[model samples]
Target: MKKTNIFKIAFILTIGLASIFSSCKKDAGPAGPQGAQGAQGPQGLQGTPGPAGSTVLSGNGTPTSTTGANGDFYLDLTSSLFYGPKTAAGWGTGFAMKGANGAAGTNGNKIINGTTIPGATDGSIGDYYLNTTNYLLYGPKIASGWGVGTSLIGTANVKYSGWATSTDPINVGYGKTSIRSARINTTAITPAIINSGVVLVYARRNSDLILPGGTTPLPFSYDLSVVENIKATVNFSLGTSVIYINTTTSNNSLYAEATLEYRYVVIPGGVAIAAAKNINLNDLQAVEKYFNIEK
Candidate 1:
């Protein structure tokens, strides 16, 4: 009986061990939810830079070299032209930068400036100077030292003297009745003004300073101020510097009385400038307004 009991106990323990081993061999349960994704990879290396663009250049003459890179510009001062936007082939066609060659210019005179008066040795003939103290302009230095310095402001050196008149006309020689006139003293007239400056004249008549028709509107039907030579006409004998208020007839005749009044003006420039401005010599009021002339 004791032996049989021992065998039964061994058999029971073996059966329990076999059951536990079978559970371990069964298939695994569904996989748990996937875990969060892993971290990102590292950055890549940088790329190389590109080549530079063009440049500009200039020279006295044509370009002979291809040393300059593509898309460049070159100027030729000798030819006054431009060659450019260079290509791999070479410099492009050249085009003129200025107009046709002009006439040679006159030599320019030298100039000097100082607080003291300019000495003759300071500059050569035709040279100029400016006084720092008075702001006066001195020019075309001569063998002598500076003369009077001109003021840039105000009118030129023309003197504004009162009106001068001629003495009465007297018949002279064989041309007596046909041409009579008076000569007035004109020491004030300068040779320089007559040569290069401007001169203007205005005329009137009688002690009352009336028009040539003598106190009447233009185109007089009859003669006025003709006590003697009624056939003679009245006009001007210009060029003795502001002239003779002479009496002249048809183009074929002459003779004049010094019985008229006259006035004059002077400007500095070519006569063409006065004509170009379209001055009306007959219009006293207009002339006064344009040139600031005194009545």
Candidate 2:
């Protein structure tokens, strides 16, 4: 009986310990399935761009070529260029650009031609004696009228009283002003069949010969008589002909019409007369007497 009780007590104690351990382990709930991955957050903004690379030309440049024996360099300017204004045709190689043309020469010198003694002379019509070989018995004086010549006649009568200012009657020409005067009249003047010669007339102004206004000189009429510091020269061109004229020594005196004069008038009718009396009327306008230049 004592051994049975001891065994029984041991068995009870073991059973009680097992029951306590079982209670402590209450059931672990099934593992929760992973919640759908949280929706992905919005993607971050893109990064900034890097620096630019080196420049590169896109199309082919003008064709580089050597000239042929005929001195011809043909280039087709079909390609676009950055230069302003379209290029002109027939442009040569080396591609150097050209600047605008320099301004044209000024027009102030006078041109005159006549049939009587139509050659350059040292004296004026009033003072110039006919080379005698080609003068009429009695003709007009130098200061007043023209003489016969081959191609042109020029005369200078220096009435130098004093330098006339722009406001002076001589400079502005009121009426019969007493200023020094030079006259150049181109007449197809013919000498008396008795005694006659030829003269050559050159049209020259003060030699400085600068472009008017130092810029582009357009085609226009200018009165050389009104110009300042102007001295004229006369030359004759006798192609295959000898010209002569006759004049008395009295008509060729210095300080007479032979002396350089500085006065002239704008003869509207005179220009027409000069044209009608000479060949190629278009070439004999008074404006043409001053200076003529063609672009």
Candidate 3:
């Protein structure tokens, strides 16, 4: 009976050992293969800079253009721009001074500055000078007249005064006189200014300035008081006389005469042309020799 029991126990132990070996074999598994790589991710966004950065004009805050001279009305600034004529608001002020009469000042008059005395005629009439250094300067007077047509005619062989300089030197005639200093004489030869007449003034280039005309002939009367220089001519076409006036450049058509009236024509070289007195077209040849015409 002991031998039988030993054999049964040995059988049971072998069964348990075999079962444990079988379970260990079942727990073991096969190895897996390598997996494929994934696609690349999207790029990250850029970060902003810190504060205290420089500001620039980025938007369409376009600059405006200025017009002509009238467009000078705006100002430009570094950071921004603005227009001129700036207005101010909310204003206040406070200041005051008390007067006290002290010792009486010297019993005399205080000379104010730049005071021009009236009727200060010490300066010769027609003399041009600046009250101050910056003021305009001119020479003595050569003529004076009132109205638009008043004039001054120089004496033969003699130049007018007021300019202080001899006519022979300048060769240029005296211009219009300034009435501010000397008064005008509104006589028979009154200037046109009195009756819608145009006021003109000019200087002769040489003595030949007042020449006679080819057709019409008349007397030319001018002011003698204000002429600076002059030269007498031998033109006999001016049957009566010739006068050179200081007139404007545009008044060149003053040489006209009616029938039975003396005809005068202003010619080139400042010469006034006129016909001989009482000389008809038939007798023109006789007196023509006396007047000295090229024909």
Candidate 4:
């Protein structure tokens, strides 16, 4: 009877163990649906500010109703500063210094009417003015009342012998004078002469006078010889003063005769000459037509 009880207890224990193993075993199947997504994280911090840019012109600060006169207007910039057209009051507290003026607009050619030429006192040099009285156009005035129509003329002469050394003063019929003098010889190419007045000298061989040189020389030959072919240099002084002529020569065979020509004009008091005008090209065309240079 105890042996029968032991066997029954063993069978009961084995069945209980099999039931536990079957309950733990799992069968393969599809995965369950994924869970819902989680919420997003908090926002990031803000970035730093960027560098400033170049200043820009905003607008004219002057009132809209009034046109800006030279010193009345100021310019506004992106930085909120005011710059100017400087006035006597200057750029005050809120304003920056004045800026340079803008480029000037182009001007048209000037036109003059009539012949009563405008007096020199009337306009600036290079400014053109017309004379209404005469039909002629007068301009490019050099001095008071010294316009295109005025002129003076005169004549004079001087004679020198080859033996003369130094200079001889000559009084040309004109009131003009001499300022300088020089001489040119066969050996030298140039002579020193003055800037004013026209003086021309002619040299000629006087007779067949020969010093210590060969005979039968070539005619009109300007060479180094006993009869030196010397030429006179002449110059005149300012305003009807004195004129000088170089008359020195190594030989006595050369003689010189000079002729003088001069011209001048008288200017009226307080009547200055006008300067050339931009219209001078047209004026020149008219002048050329008047002189028959252009048909």
Candidate 5:
């Protein structure tokens, strides 16, 4: 009687357990809340820039009678000007896109012009200094401390080229038609540039790069100088500037007969000596690079 009772009790217990499990139809309670996401990884290196598109035409010089569709455009690497929207006649006149001029960079209060030891708060890590006392420029305030200031005075002072002249000349002008000049776009000389303190620095191409008025280049050691050569003179008015090549030293020729091309640079404030010693002034490239200029 005891064995039978024990077996019956065990069977009843097992059946009760199975019924309890069966009553609960759910196998897993509604899925638990999703785990939090893991932290993201660091970013990869930046990619390089792409090349120019098909629509752009890169050439040695500016477009003249070169033909192009209405949508087509030309980039004169020599002239550094962008010309486009060509019609059936020829390439339309365009403005200068990039040149050796223009204030592509900005200098904050970092450049201390007066004579004084710049305070720590005067400028940040890369700020500059110029002690007028010594005309010593840009100590280049650094993390450790202000670096030894570089002297940009006397002979070391670089001349300025605030305004970049066109590779070509202003072909059309009214003044004394006797002067030889290049085809220069009026827009090349900005009003701000003309209005700024600047002086003239001209470059003469003895041989026309693209015109019939070219000749054997003269062997002149001083090709680029502030000194006036070839009876060259510039007349500035409003936004337009005209350079008159009155005569050529290489050959005694009349302006009407000679097809010459002139390229000039106008350094604002006459010479760059008056500019800050922090960086080279009048050079578009220097400004662009110093200020991290980009598209």
Candidate 6:
């Protein structure tokens, strides 16, 4: 019996130990499913700045405000810059110097005619002289002796101060007729006969004349002709000729008067006509003299 009780006690002890072990022991339950992720954090602050850097120099020398001349070239050391010459007032931006002027050249030789006259004085191309005997101006010396100088007479020599006119009444026939006439008397001037002479004549009708029966006057038609002679029938005298006006009309009853205006000039001898050039009327002095106008 005691043996049986001891076996029962042993069995009861075994049962208690088994109960305690079972209470202490545990089994991992499949890592208990993963947890959810967390939210993102705010950004970090910026870092502080480092020390300042050194300056880099440019150009030559330093920068300066120095006075310069007109054409001087220079550089500013302070600002490391280049410039032109400096004057007393301030620096200049233009050329610094000017060159000297050159010398005048020698004149060329004077020539006249084919002869190359001896004792010819030094003179310019257009130098001229009036010949006392012939009363002509000569010069503009060329290789050939004073080439044909200008004629001091005629249109070239004399000035036409004014004009003179004369009128004559006439009756016209069917054909052309010498209706009226006038003359340019060479004796009228201080010198009767000029070495070189020139004359100008102009003619026209004074007014229109009506025919006997017709109310309207026929158109006046006329022409002029100059002749050099001493005939009593001729109107002009003493070296000059007479200028005549001839008129004509289809109507026989036409009566008209003709008028004439004329001027002339006389030139003495000695001027080289061949070498002389024609004078233009535009020359103020010549024109004034020709018109007999004072300037």
- Lowest lDDT sum, 10 consecutive residues, model 1, at 215-224
Query: How should the candidates be ordered by lDDT, best one leading?
Result: 1, 5, 6, 4, 2, 3
What TM-score do all the candidates reach, one by one? 0.33, 0.13, 0.12, 0.19, 0.24, 0.26
Off-target runs (Cα >4 Å) in candidate 3 are 1-112, 117-192, 196-200, 207-295
Show pairs that collide, candidate 1: 179-255, 180-255, 247-256
Give residue 30's lDDT in candidate 3 (0 to 100): 90
Question: Among these predicted structures, which one has the highest TM-score?
Answer: 1
Per-model tally of clashing residue pairs: 3, 66, 52, 21, 12, 29
Instruction: Please give me the total number of clashing residue pairs in predicted model 5.
Output: 12
- lDDT for every model? 0.57, 0.31, 0.28, 0.36, 0.48, 0.39
Question: Model 3, 45-72: lDDT tens per residue?
Answer: 9889865432222122223432112222
- Model 1 RMSD vs true structure: 19.6
Q: TM-score-based ranking, best first? A: 1, 6, 5, 4, 2, 3
**RMSD (Cα, Å) of candidate 2?**
26.8
lDDT of 1 by residue, 38-112 (tens): 999888788798887778788888886664777888888799789888887888778999988899999889877
Task: Give candidate 5's whole-model lDDT.
Answer: 0.48
| TM-score of candidate 5 against the unseen true structure | 0.24
Q: Between prediction 1 and prediction 4, which has the larger TM-score?
A: 1
45-78 per-residue lDDT for model 5 (tens digits): 9999886443767788767674455567888887
Prediction 6 global C-alpha lDDT: 0.39
lDDT of 6 by residue, 87-114 (tens): 4555434331334567887765443332
Worst lDDT run of 10 residues, candidate 5, spans: 215-224
Model 3 TM-score?
Answer: 0.12
lDDT of 2 by residue, 1-295 (tens): 9999999999999999999888777754678888877888999999999864423122345533322222233333444332222223322434434556799986432334333444445344444333333222222335445433322233121011111111111112223322222323323332321133322221212322322332211121222333442322221222222211111122112121132112112223333344235333222222233222111
